[model samples]
Target: MQKDEQRNIILAIVLSLAILLGFNFLTAPSEEELAAQRAAFEAEQAQLAEDANSGDPSTPQLDSTLSAIENAAAGLTAPLDRSEALDQTPRIAIRTPKLEGSISLRGGRIDDLTLSTFFETIQTDSPNITLLSPVGSLAPYYAEFGWISSDSSIAVPDSKTVWSSTVDTLTPSQPVTLFWENGSGLRFEREISVDENFLFSVKQRVINNGSSATELAPYSLISRTGTPELLGFYILHEGPIGVLDNSLVEVDYDDLQDEKLIQNRTTGGWLGITDQYWLTALIPDQEQSVQTRFVYTGKGNTTRYQTDYFYDPVAVSAGETVTFDSNVFLGAKEVTLIDDYQEELNITDFDLAVDFGWFYYITKPMFFALHWITGVVGNVGVAILILTLAIKIPLFPLANKSYASMAKMRKLTPKMTALRERFGDDKQKLNQEMMNLYRQEKVNPAAGCLPILIQIPIFFSLYKVLFVTLEMRQAPFFGWIQDLSAPDPTSIINGFGLLPWDVPELGILGFINLGVWPILMGLSMFLQQRLNPQPTDPVQAKVFMLMPFFFTFLLATFPAGLVIYWTWNNLLSIIQQALIMKKAGVPLGRQPDEA
Candidate 1:
């Protein structure tokens, strides 16, 4: 027993040391080799360019074919845009064409504005405001402020002051102010600021010099590319409780590769907004007092409008100043940090609680706790190891009892074999006798499976953490393993320059390559299983032994972090099993001695 325990401890230490060394080796790259590789790639690209320009018919044709394939692939993956208004029948314009308010600001004729024309006008020199359009191509176009208004009657003292065709220099630090005076002796002033680094703000100040103290409900009309149809705009809210994107809830997935956007709407409640391609608005609300409406117009000759109303609106009192602030995020979904911020803009029928439910109530807090501990350790890999140890320690007593129960079962195996032989054709009677014997001995037949059952959830949760958590994304372990979020680094066949299969030419390898991690993972699984007690049922044991191979195939396409976690788990399990067996006074042999 002492010898077995000592052996288990030694094995555990050795395995841990080996994993650390492997990680170190994977992260460090030889500077000379990297420099040489970069130079070679540059030279190859230059050569390819020169060849393509040499008027070689075959080369040009090949390039065209490749380009077409790439475009087709991109089109397949890109989301469909739903902001065009051309699909629906035209309705009467909601606002009046002519201005009749206390303050007369610039107004325009609806007929003179084509989507293209409006976009063009903004493209001209405008410093205060910009116009963005979604036409000609998918790329976004920015337009500067211009002198012309929809109503040509309103003239500014200086056209140059009204608009500048250059990029707006107004930043969050210093804002631009606009003042307008109408025939009714009403004056309107607003401050606006926008910066390259996502900062947009607007403040409106209205003053009524008229003796009647005329009341005016203020509204501004600004054209944007991806506005929601119903409210003629989108609303995004941020608050201390949580962020709401058009009010939609967020979800997490075990495998991002398996994720698909599934739309579900609830009846008799806010259906919440769904964005086909682009998100349009962000609003910050501190209290239930905020009320806003979002209207969207679809793109491309189809004029469809959708409206959303927020009843519990955050309000601004008359003659009282209130500030609405929120950070707006726009970009790709795969970029998680940015996307998380953008998610606040989505609207959903149901409110999302920070704690998802009892499940989240438990898991999220635990996740944070584990995250803190791991982060303090400096290396996430080491943190994971420590977490694994922490989990295993709590299960030690249960696992130890299970092992003892299994030892008793092992002692009875010879007697069971004799009984089986005696009742070769009387299986029912043999089973009844075996049950009676187990009851008399106070042994639970399922005891051997307990440890495995108990460990499954922890194992799966670890898998989720390693694969889905942002912490592991692009994290480094050791030499060659530059990105834990990707497959291990390895050549197709040692010296083969080409990978075994064709993959998109991105990243360092130019193809999806499975590195040494999966291979090591499989080996560890096999070793752990070999060291475990053989099942009394030979067929079951054989099936169990094949699991390592199955896992190897499944893991080949998974992130390296997952493979590393599983490999370490198996190594630890082997150590635990050895210790358990030692405590049971069991010898390392194919079969146990009869009781």
Candidate 2:
């Protein structure tokens, strides 16, 4: 009888897993896939805008030339290919160990940049991820530093201004100084210096050698043309973000478009447009008071997301030189790199560029833990495992106490069952007696749930770490899990490729992926649940029994690394709970052993 009951329990768990796996086949689409759908929709919208504005006006422009550029987007602002537009622009080469691109000499714009370390795909030979593109490119994104003079006659550098440079290339050790002089005798020189990584120090100086003193405010702007389709996930912020006067601020592109503009005047902060993995931020003088804006301008088919800042006006006397120094950050949001810059350069909250969501406290610490372990272990997957263990250490005492309470409840079940039978239909009396029993035994039935609830944030924070940061983008694990940031590619329906039949792309129903790691995860979850006595209430027991199976299937299509972590977490939890159960002398079975 004992063996049969065990077999039945085993069979039930297996059946649940199978049913859940089938349900997974009908699961929802992933964010990346949804993003593609949104892209298509946006493309259609762009076509409609072009048709509607074929001869219409109301499209605002910065100047008449900007209006001409937008109107002649066919051959100017909106080019089909980025390379074509880039080739047409006169650019000074920018080369660094980590980054390679060009500064467009036409507008003195840092527009063409590609991260040498990051690739579009896992394939080693794949093209590098393009960070900044020229103004006429598909998604025009670039940063430019200029003078915003209170006096309009000073002839501050414009987009059409052709700056002359002495150097052919801007390197880490070699700085490039571009000089452009107005016929009015005022000369502007910008000396640009880049670090080994992404930080670019632009020191702009104005020399009033010809005439009277002029008042000028140094300004920097990062502008992106066309609303690049965002991930659209509320938890993940992908748009304008800044730290103004020690307070962190973030704004969505669509939100800015709807509201028109968001302006804030503060002492100092860094502001920029951030994507899921890539970012381009304009960092102003850390100590100077400045006004920043997350502004949007939509005209016809052209929409621009611009994050700009202008320092308070500085007066430059005749024969005097006024210098303004600021930094521009353009690269992948690597945790260590950003945090290092934040600490070393004294840039306020630079690491916040990677969206850690509302629970940044938990998320950042968790990422740091994982990052530290990755350095030691040399594998992000194993690093994640160590991080999981590290997080569990702090909650050990709480979990131990909770488990002890559960064990005590397990021992008192018989008396409770007898009391239930005695009470019969007397509901109020039964409740009072149960409360009295609970008080006397010093047992809280809800105690065990607290530990489970705590894991929610830890799990969510880990999810955020895996989702947004490029550090883990193509991080690999053991067999079948190449990218920690991507879903498992292997599926059970195809017999793991043993059978020749192809499985359909199950969009959101990715749980149908049913990879090897998910199967192990399901098993670990089952074993964890078995560490405790089953609930006496049939409905509760059934729900508890099926949860592991449901989650196993549901998470199968998730990032393989997360599933691996989940499985490891469940296994650790099972061991922990079992040790606690034994230490507290809790009965393994529902009924106490009968001799």
Candidate 3:
């Protein structure tokens, strides 16, 4: 009977600790923290606008050019292109024979006709025009530019131009001169500087030798026509500072139900399209300011447009040369490289949160400050360890107080047990007696639960910080954990590729391919629980042990960062509990009440 009673006491202590750990792990943020974060974001945006407008040279030019472009677009008629005709067969189709290569130029507009495809990287080596179009099994078609015409009717000429490495020999910063004489006695001669960076700036001098002011409307427009499915996802942005259209749709083969585009409107930002595997950002030069509009063409010839104002329209006089220059950024979403360029592009917003309370506000700043520091530390895993230790040390006093409360409660458990036996089945009388006894001893039954309640939110807020924030998306932790956003790299049922447990292939189960880390996490949790106090009741002991297994299964598909945080937290709890036990003069094997 004594052994059974001792076992129950231990089990109760362990259960209390487990409950505290779980709660603390989940509640790191309060409502006030969230409100503060929102306020901070708004203030930052206001400051950015003020700085951008102060001593700004691009404003006047941008306002003027935007007016001109809008006026010109309003007056223009649809071109007689083959694709525009309702009766004509789809004869004109854009083909991308090669989807890879670089272009010449650092920062300037190039005529769309000069390039083979729209999706080309700008690099010093292999400085030739390349475009991105679905040729073999890919979807959607979009083009980048070295030069674009202001006149929309001038269709891009379809010509087989062999752009080879020989052209790469030409210095990107060098000048290229071109002369053309049409049958109409109109001579077009221009000398443009091709920067060593692969961008070209052209000053077009059109000599209308044939009398009267030429009434030709000059503009540039990129056109596309194809089955909607053939174009997986298409998004067009007018400039760096623009709002995307919400009507953009994602083509899903299985469901045939289109996915809606999520639009965000705030300060200037980049455009990202997942199905296209492409991201484009506008890089504006001081000489030419730019704004952006997002265009989405959906199935059944439906079109959606959202415009953001940046600059005014530009006009060129007849018999005179006018210059318009802007930079274009075309590439994949490489987080580190993209961030480096984003600073140069004057982009400031990058998501990185730590928690959702005062701690979150404090931690968010630290995360940003330590970003470069953490990156240099060789591994993000080590960075997390350092950050955890830094936080825990400061809160050590509170933690110690909570532990002391629990030790005091453990000392009074024997008297409580005696009261239970003395008034067996007399619930009302037993409660009165227990309360009187607690009062006499100056003990509070709830004191032990306070530390746990306080820490629960902090733990949860940290989980949110590590999981949802974009800063940690592609961050590398330790070996094999290449991307913190993804699950750890370990699979149990390998080779045959069979689904585990014969569960239905849907929802969460369908997505979880790796299950090794979760198992290890469960094992660690079980060990941690074993090291703490055990429950006396068989049912309660079973519940305590089974929790680790339940958590392991629940976390099987979570991001590696989340798992790392939980595992470390459990380890810390074990250490803290051991320290408290030693300080209270409780022997490892002896019952606390007996002492």
Candidate 4:
């Protein structure tokens, strides 16, 4: 019977694979068909872009003046190469230990910046990761700071205004001060300072030297032209995000497209656009109330996403100077650095920018634990192993109880089978006898589920840590696992690199290409299942038997670190369960039905 069951399970899997492979082969496109599909896809994309550019009738339109200002601010004209865009404007070199870039002087925009420590790829000579780019670039992303006035005649520094800088280069010790006179007795001074890290402080000061007093409001914005490719996972937010009125506001790019504009009023909060590992946020004065907005605009193939804050208008008396202090964060979202900035800079909920997900409580502690372990052990992979052991230790007593219960239930299988035979063809009587048996033996059939239930949150939290945290990005494990945050690069289709040919892209069926680590994980899961009591029903037993194979394919696309954790966790569970079952005098290998 056992051999027959094993044969049935293997046959089912082989048949499933055969059907999938046959379908894939039958549906495969020829060269001409592929070219035609590509052309159709291109045309569809162009039409979508045209539809986006064509304004929606229901969506409110901005006035011509504001529209012009936005278009100019975003440099929504014809796109140019990044190099050409950077050369078109005069810039002050930004020199720091961790950053290498320049600040454009024409618009006083903090653009054209790159991370000195990070690269576009793992290759040796890859270019640095460019965080900000100037206007006219294919994808313009930048931060701009200045003042706005209700008085139409009042001239304020804008995107077209050219300001003189006090220094040719900006460094940690040397700040750059930009000066711009409106030719109307108003002198605007912007002092920009940076630290050794990602934080930048910008002090906007205006001197009212005119005969009449005027009111000016300071505004700062971070804008990106063109929609960026998103990770598209619901677990992490990757578009417009902010903390407003002490509440976190996350709006997806598509959501903003439908809503058009989102407005809120807050005191001392931050607003910005975020990617998986990087962020660009504007921090307004904590003591002052400001109106914040997340806006979206589309033109031709170009789209603009912006997050900005407008401080309450301040009246500057004649001969009096008013200063507004704010800050902009542009760089990698380092967990420790972000936490420190939150504490030191008094930014509210700044750590939320890291997207710890709903399990922030569990996920954050897990990350800190793993981070600390890595610091001591000097390898993130080793840290993961140690952290898993530590977690197991704390849950040891509960798991032991669950395993003991399962062992006792397995030992009572003989009595259960007799009860089923005695109550043959009577489902109700069989259930009654099973309940009475459980009561007499003082063994709970559901107790074995406790360990699995507990693991649900732990599993989700660890998955969140692996998916959202920047520290795990590009982190290396032993062997071919150079990026813990990415999927395993080696596939069985390529004989795990034994063959020179690469795996062909199979669209939705790409998960069929199993990696070495995932296969090991699936095997461990299967072995671990052998020690547990099998389901009595044949159909359920078959489904349970297939779970390992199902998970192997499901988790192939997950981060390598997560797959390693699961594999190690399954092995540990196997060892622990084996010992517990042996101590309980429960047979380890034989199924109750087979016995």
Q: Clash number for every model?
A: 66, 5, 60, 0
Q: Is candidate 2 or candidate 4 better by TM-score?
A: 4
Error of 3 at 37 (Å): 35
Candidates sorted on lDDT, descending: 4, 2, 3, 1
The runs of at least 3 residues in candidate 3 whose Cα sits more than 4 Å from the true structure, single-residue gaps closed, are 1-100, 103-137, 141-278, 283-292, 299-312, 319-321, 332-344, 348-374, 419-485, 491-507, 510-516, 530-543, 587-595
Best by TM-score: 4
- Colliding residue pairs in candidate 2: 27-508, 27-509, 28-508, 28-509, 29-508
Cα lDDT for residue 334, candidate 3: 32
State in Å the error of residue 382, model 2.
1.4
Mind giving the per-residue lDDT tens digits that candidate 4 earns over 410-520?
Answer: 788777767767886887777777777777877766666666666666767777888788888888999999988877888999999999999777555666778999999
lDDT of 1 at 393: 85
Model 4's alpha-carbon lDDT is: 0.79
Candidate 2 overall lDDT versus native: 0.75
Ranking by TM-score: 4, 2, 3, 1
Q: Residue 565 of model 4: what lDDT?
A: 90
Where's the lowest-lDDT run of ten residues in candidate 4? 53-62
Q: How well does model 3 score by local distance difference test?
A: 0.41
Q: Could you tell me how far off, in angstroms, the CA of residue 594 lies in candidate 1 after the best superposition?
A: 13
Question: Which window of ten consecutive residues has the lowest lDDT sum in model 2?
Answer: 52-61
